[model samples]
Target: MIDYTKWDEYYDGGFADEEPINNFNEEYDERSELEKLEYGGQKTNVTAKQIMQETGTTAISEKFLYRNGVVIILLDYSKGIFDKWKNGRILHCLGDRTYTTQQNTNGLSIIDRTLFNADSIDKIIVRAFWKDETKKYRLVNGLLVLSKEKPYTIEENGKYRWVFPLSLMSKYNFQMPEKYSYFLDIKSVKEAALINADKEDGVRLTTLNKLARFSSSKNDIHYKRTPQKKIKYTSVQEKIERSSKIAENALILADFKCEINNDHFTFIRKNQNVPYTEAHHLVPLAYSDLFNYSLDVEENIISLCSTCHNQIHYGKDSESLIKKLYANRKELLKEAGIVLSEQELLEMYNNS
Candidate 1:
């Protein structure tokens, strides 16, 4: 399991282990610790040329730290973008304490922006400047749930914005990957982020547009919807049954693997080898047309990793709920090993 607390907030190292080595003074060397994290046990540097070739994004020349390990992120950026950086620490004192990391580029230095792709790159170092906020962490099922939900209303620029304490911080001295999962909720084009606008929205819907650039996903989502109604069913029972067919059929096509509830994705850190992945739906039956008797189909469904799934439904998107779905329709069909058509979906079928 990845030590998210160490990366997300200040590190106290959980009740002072026996070894208790104080290496804060020592420089962060990523290569040295690979042995403890992975099976192969070797930390390697990612090249800029390789990143550009695979990601199809450009980067300006600049140097930054990743996971305390050496990472290459190329992005065109101006200077002094990370000015609002506030130093913070996560004190595990008695039980769970409170903390939040924010990411808003005064202006992202290209490489700083995270790009949409497959898999989570754990070896990245970022500096997290924090301010004292009222929210903290809640441990559920041995997982640390940030106090992002119960946000207190705040006035930034003469408007109300729910300021979340949690956001992306600079990855300067990335810790070695222990037996844990890592997630990069945010990233940049290359070494730097694309923008530095703090406070996603200031008191108006217009300002919300500014935040659109930050929606970088780790992988393209995948999900399918059930075929349309074919039968002339009219009774309430018929409607319920019809809806169920659509939702169920859609899920059947995706192999019932809730992408929004599973891993972000899989991809080779280096090489052409692809990774394993499944599909997830954005619109869950709990909130959507998924009914006690029928399928719930409204306009809100998406495919996502377990983490993004939790984030999308649990949080409010200001005016609407940000939904996700599969990015590739053909891939979804191929996975299901069957073909469907818009016409077949809409018309009820019976023995000819």
Candidate 2:
């Protein structure tokens, strides 16, 4: 077995001297980050499971999952690699009922045992998380199967496509957890090799390299014009302006509402399709904290009618009226699919 702990030394100057990235930006923090990665680190041999757990995602040169969604690994668990005691290196047939530990002499399959050793048989479980546009994550609703015939491929824009390694794409047979939030562990394994809850984060970070990205670049990428680098340059100013526009769009996406009661309605008789309320982003582009454009996810925006918008500036009678409006329209609110909790409404009010 490879000693993964030795990886710390190896990762000192890691990512096989770092992954290649396409773009080049000297003043960008991304460049600094790339330079700092495993800046002076060493590496250790780690298991595929360990690396996968650490980074929350991994792509292997070999295919592991098929296009139709199947899984192929139970990991080294069954091989007794995760057992607590080294001597009990026995194999367990599928559906075997009992097993014996090193402390006792008799051999049982999947029954009772006093001492749990390193050679104990166990199963491996897996789950996944994804990084969405805003650098926040929503658990994946479905899963894919991984098999020898159906290995997966890492595609551009960071998508995982399922395919076979050698020839044809194969389907795997395994049930994924209903929810994406989960952990994989060695089941029925010995306690010594078992990781405790506290150190799990460490294990994950050490093995997976959670924050590292492979930085790739094309060859013959020589710079022609020698422009001296300066941080004060206004080149990113244009980029910042564009970023604001995207942020505004994100606000509109999040705060979409049909009506805020007829009282606040615009009553455009010609166009009844228009919503009575105006949806907006909470963090106005005026705020400098947001840069590189902001994601138009739910957390960044909200919807309100003209009355509420005006009342936001002069918040008093409108606050009570808004509360009553929301309370009274609880059912109508459901029609628009916006039934915010009292606490949430209050938070929006406060933030606004």
Q: Please write out the lDDT profile of model 1 over residues 1-352, one tens digit for every residue.
A: 3333232232322322223223422322332332221111112123434333433434333332232222232211133222221122111111111123223322332223322110122542222211122111111111111121222334344533232222222222332222111121112122221121111111111221222121223243323344332344567445444443333333333433444443445433122122222122222222112122211332222223344434543444411223123233423432332232322211111100
Error of 1 at 90 (Å): 69
- lDDT for 93 in candidate 2 is 13
Give the range where candidate 2 is weakest over 10 consecutive residues by summed lDDT: 85-94
Q: How close is candidate 2 to the true structure, as a TM-score?
A: 0.22
Instruction: Count clashing pairs, candidate 1.
Output: 70
- Model 1, TM vs. native: 0.18
The local distance difference test score of model 1 is 0.26
Q: Which stretches of candidate 1 lie over 4 Å from their true place?
A: 1-232, 264-311, 317-352
TM-score, per-candidate, Cα-based: 0.18, 0.22
